[model samples]
Target: MKLIAKSMLVMGMVMSLTACKKESKLNPIPTSLISDASAYDSPDRIATLVNGLYATFKGSGFFGTQYIYYSEARSGDFISTNLNPTRGGLTYQMTVDPGISDVSAVWTQGYQIINACNVFISSMEEKGIKVLTPQIANNYLAEARFLRGLSYYYLLQLYAEPFTKNNGQGKGLPLRLTPNKGLAEYNLARSSVAEVYKQIITDLDYAEANLPANYSSAALNTTRAHVNTVISAKTNVYLSMGDYANVIKEADKIVPATAPFVAPTGVKNALQTEVTAIFKAPYTTTESVFSMPFSNTDVPGTSLANAYLPDGANATGLGSAGTGDFYLFEGGIVSDPLWKTTDKRRALVFTTIAGGNKGRQWSTKYATGSPYTDYVPVIRYAEVLLNLAEALANVNGVDSRSLALLNAVRQRADQTTTLTASSQPELISKIIHERHIEFLGEGIRNADLMRLKLSVPAKTPLGSSPVPQINPENPNYLWPIPNTESLYNKDI
Candidate 1:
């Protein structure tokens, strides 16, 4: 039951020599292979391992596509047009099991990333420090820890129960900190969710302390983990735990105390005047706090565009052409009256009027055609703002700062609207609704529902495939530990 697949082991070995230099900042050329004895002998080789860690983290099975797709599809947002299990049709219907390919792939790839990080960190501790400057070595170490924490956090979200359940006393992931280099390291049991979160926070805290506050370029700022990036990620992780107080504390480290909430210290991350601008070319906006960048050469093949965009050429010319795997359900968040037609965010949705796909509406957020090189957004400044707002409302009860934070996101897309709530619950509800509208296709809905201990809302039937409402008590509410893990890891 080796968690590191033979293929991934080869990938990990090759990555040490020839990393994916998707951008000039992460350039790694094909050099002759080096054995374990000399793998961490030079600064350049160590740096290539850092870039390679990101490449693995952004694999199509992880953040590059399937993870986002699975998260959104499990929610009530999109209607599955394809019943192909290979394409996540079972996930859309909330029928994902240990045997589902996508489920198994996510589990396998996620651990691959975690193990890669462990190996990188262990190697650096053993040898990299002697070759690279202490500061450089620590920075690389922080990056690996940050990625490992993030991987565990996401895996916990889908594979385990909500952290809010009994204060994270539920079953969580195997807390594998050391490198899993061979067959003997595969029998570990799941940690309590609390223990896993403790490690996530520990890893992120180190990352925040060691990671650079900013990068030399915008691409690096968005793609690489910086101090603010670690802070932003902490805010998300805390919010998921229902730890509102800590969410506000972490968010405040980067977000301002006042309006026009640009990060004063780091990348100056603030919302774009136009929501669509963040999704357009150059995809390096301040609002894009962290994302998986893809170049024409290193694309997320058959990814977001293939799953969310329309199958043919779009009528509006926004997303151009897509595979049309799923469409906006007539009953999804788009149908809310609060989501006014005047809202600029509406442009992300394109309605088909005359074709086999007629009457169907598609999300054009990941609009890039063919090669599907859209940068997959993992966390955004806007999410930090919203997380702060939610925390504030919960902690202070209809506070002014909460109202302002909520309005900042709302008015950005729909200027004509100004939201107000008389009670704390109402304000919280409004904030949740705003999230649904703001992050419709960016993969926040399902996590939101899960964190709040809410049921997965029923989706409108597309022909005979009717997706039912999944309550929190249902076994299907949380994806099972994939057979890939269960069959191998005896502890399960």
Candidate 2:
């Protein structure tokens, strides 16, 4: 029954894509048409439709470019490197648009996905499918909530200001649960960031309560649906809320390290323990709570070959027809030796390419299969440790555990010696800086910068001198609602 509903949904989406004729511009999602109650009566079909909800979040065109990579890349962590100089300037504008294009894409895609999930949940409830127990049904809802919360989290960062509410209150994207049928719903105004966060917490709590401990099957666990990803996501939310204690608590729920730390094995670039293993693609190491796996077949442009395939570079094995996935430091800024040499993060994520590639040296970290095989990992275990360390230090200042966590990451990168102990404030500042360096391209830096109430120093590498700063006082931090939405809705 679930399968049938899923097929129908896929068919429906495909038809819509076909009618729009924009399917080629983006990856085609498997959609079906389950229009009436008669088709939904079967429990199996209902389950299938629920399953299709996961596909909506997969690497579609808009999702791949806007949500996963471009959004994070445009933030201060990375400078624009062009594979095709003539046409790449606009791509570089992502950094200056203040994430407008990325934010708009996220707003559209997230709401589309949320409506799908809500529809599935509603449909499943209507069907008396004892197929999954109540706990299981709730678990599905939790996953939906988790994804919705995540979308909102991104929106808050890109569109709203720093969290200033006493209990997480501030203007945030409108809370849209059901699909809007007309202009009335579109007439709503922005809610506070605090209000948005409360919903995020509510969704995460629901997910935590009903999700399973772990799933053995990689496809089912990592791809289909499982608990770890949701937990990892929850940890991210905790960090965003400045709730360090909860970050530690939620991360532990995923990987309970009975021992202090374990060394990484197998892969040459592996991290120290099973927990760290999640960072790598192979060996479903105990650490990965939630990661969007990119297969040569599953995702549209996440392969290494596609990402790294130079604009005119040959297609080595699979044919010379793919585009490069990884972006090198082309602005001459990403190569600053001080941070580049001392901080091993550059080496870890980007592969150094020589010969003035597109006006400056370039490298590749994603795009394993050439022209696009790069898998986009949303949440990993390493982040958990960093979050824990940062949170621990923030909550209680620099301590042994925080030091240990920070050292573990530094050691993994084969970077400089460990940081000496410092005051709570000093340690917090250091941790924040390290995190910015460590997670340069992963999309969390802008939020961290805003949350800490700190300013970006005028630097040449990624940001220019007199850095474009954002805080509660800066209207620029709060992106203008897309002009299209503004025209459609009178609230603006």
Candidate 3:
């Protein structure tokens, strides 16, 4: 989602006044403020705010810009190159001090979007608008909360370390619930990770209660919001925190009554399913529970797809330097056969540029021509099933059902070998491994490694040929808070 820049702010003012319904009595604007709750009162007026929230998912300010890339960059997916560039390599990995550009951008951007959501939520009641109703106001408040929770989820992950058994015992990003009035109040201290997670859960619960089951195709493809996606995302947050019990509880709410992990028609395949469709464009599929919708309207074709495209491909007609600049996965060289050829993930997840040459086809999944408009799946039915399997395997042992779920995914990927049985440790490890492969470019690696307490050591094919050991204590594990937040809040 893109941040509402000053340019956008002006547009918002223009849009609200023109589209706002007659019933919306403009609230008295504060002297210093140019806009506020009054900006989103009537159905037409509040619609503009939805685009602002969607903007948070795009651009350089927040997750879409750098934070999302940070997760994949540190992982095996991409190496920095001339065409595909990443600051992390220049700063965090290679040098003594890296600039705070990427990480800080995400931090500041997320909070900015959160404040936007809060503005909408705080005004919903005062505006006497039915923003939560179907069609009337399109359930704006619920969507806002979901977006808010997702922002916090990313913030907590980036600013704070993974939660321990004590549940957020360590400091977390400062909780900012309301829209700021440009006050000079002291920023709150970092809350415990547990407290942050609690807030996230609370926000998601409210979102689920008010959101609808699914969106129509028109809504799905456009900037519009729906209810089911929020619920699916909540399932993801619970899984990340290792709250497997809640994972199962939340997933059950959306999964079809008969099918274990099927999403509704348009959103089906949100579950991990058939091998081929998994790889093709419409990059995100039916299985997606919640997705970050993208549009050419903001990012255009060259933004994301170009970065992941192979070097010198027809797809990249007017190639940008971002294309084929990074290594797709570490196992690009013959010496680093990290993945097996027979493993369907090899094809579905990656491609070789220039006819399968080493390092050439590595970043194939994200090509220049890939419609640039496919909503990136932040959470899908597949993850929910995997979460349930992991939780059940950890707590109840890898029984028949658990093994079935695990194998179901592997089978779809056409893995030659099948696991008969394994202990909890083995099962959990396998589950995570599947997640790593399944979600390679989608940005879930660091969180998986952190939560699992696994070493950040690189594998032979991907990292240093001998593999570099990534100690957890390394500052790279947790991204630095943005300078803006540090300047504003003392929590850093």
Candidate 4:
């Protein structure tokens, strides 16, 4: 696949590759250029390139904010209160076009990360062993592959058809593996969805074998990819592909067979005692398998906080402040009676009364004020458990282990209410509903809807206009391939 260096420059990779640095465990900025000519000259330079991949992944255009907002808003979980087009109004209304900035920005940033990973992987394979030990070199290569695989998975969720549809015999993104440097690489065609999933699994398999079992600190364990991280990601990928057997197989690597289901070997990840604690100060809990960490110095601009939190006057004692661009939809999962008011997860939603309206709820999940420093969760242990539960129920109908896994997540938040299902379909229904409640404001809804080939649910109009339900057959069901790609990559 070919992309012009000019396109890479426009994606901000030229600057991010050389200068972007976030302070944390992955510290120590480098002053060298991250070019093919000199990027692998020293050990620190190689490490800086790795960190740069993460920086680009966590940028606002991707995971930093827009991705999460796009996923949830499009699922009808959140209604646009402000209807600000720049802030995801088009996404909420299912009106995104190829030229839309959000669509283009996400695609551009995704490819930027993928290309950086390819460059880093190639450089490491060719020259990294010269500076670093073989063991360390392979570990770094695995990390690059892990990021590359994850980027492709995320892009497919929005831009391509679901793998469950006709066994992934649908158009997918360009499977760009080699480093795209010039115009010569600009005419690559899209691959099949099954082909993309094959590549994603290949990358993740290598990562599970070569990536470290655990890191030194809790922060590194939570923020960086480890053995269990790769396993957790594979479970998600397999589940999306309707490969339930593989989901169970991959999940079994980390999740135990009994209660207190902590990963026994690498990164003792388990559900937090309290659901909200995972989102609090120093958000590096074991439950957080992988997340995009942020700090006051390096924040997710105009992303989480600004998109979710209500204004100060409206928030009152919600203990947060922001522009309050979106509110929990009255017709969303929040309205489900099964999601009890006393449920601990309900604490994340707060009620605000205004303009004679009785109870308008706003999310306090990303509660930080101005700079929105909340670490965005990429995958959590709870999700892995649910994935395993759903897969088990599919493979073995109404099984005890599957029910146990389902209740593990449910009873954690709402101890008073235990879920029960008599048959396989019933059990799966409960598990799906549990996901909607458990992952609210965390950006899992739309992906769940898509992977299962479910319709984007109809939303009730509040401050903004009503959005109709979008079935799988609708043209707007999937985000269009960005115009930038269409213009540059003729084969697309």
The most accurate candidate by lDDT is 4
Q: Quick one: ranking by lDDT, best first?
A: 4, 1, 3, 2
Better of 2 and 3 by TM-score: 3
Each prediction's TM-score versus the true structure: 0.92, 0.76, 0.80, 0.93
* Model 2, span 176-217: residue lDDT tens: 665443445556677777778888888777776766554445
Residue-level error in angstroms, candidate 3, position 385: 1.5
**Tens-digit lDDT string for candidate 1 (122-160):** 888988889877777888899999999999999888988
* Candidate 3 positional error at 296, Å: 3.7
Candidate structures ordered by TM-score, highest first: 4, 1, 3, 2
Q: In terms of TM-score, how similar is model 3 to the real structure?
A: 0.80
Regions of candidate 4 where Cα sits further than 4 Å from its true position: 1-33, 353-358
Clashes, model 4:
2
Worst 10 residues of 1 by lDDT: 1-10
lDDT (CA) per prediction = 0.82, 0.52, 0.56, 0.83
lDDT of 4 at 425: 98
Superior candidate under TM-score, 2 versus 4:
4
Which 10-residue window of candidate 3 scores lowest in summed lDDT? Answer: 25-34
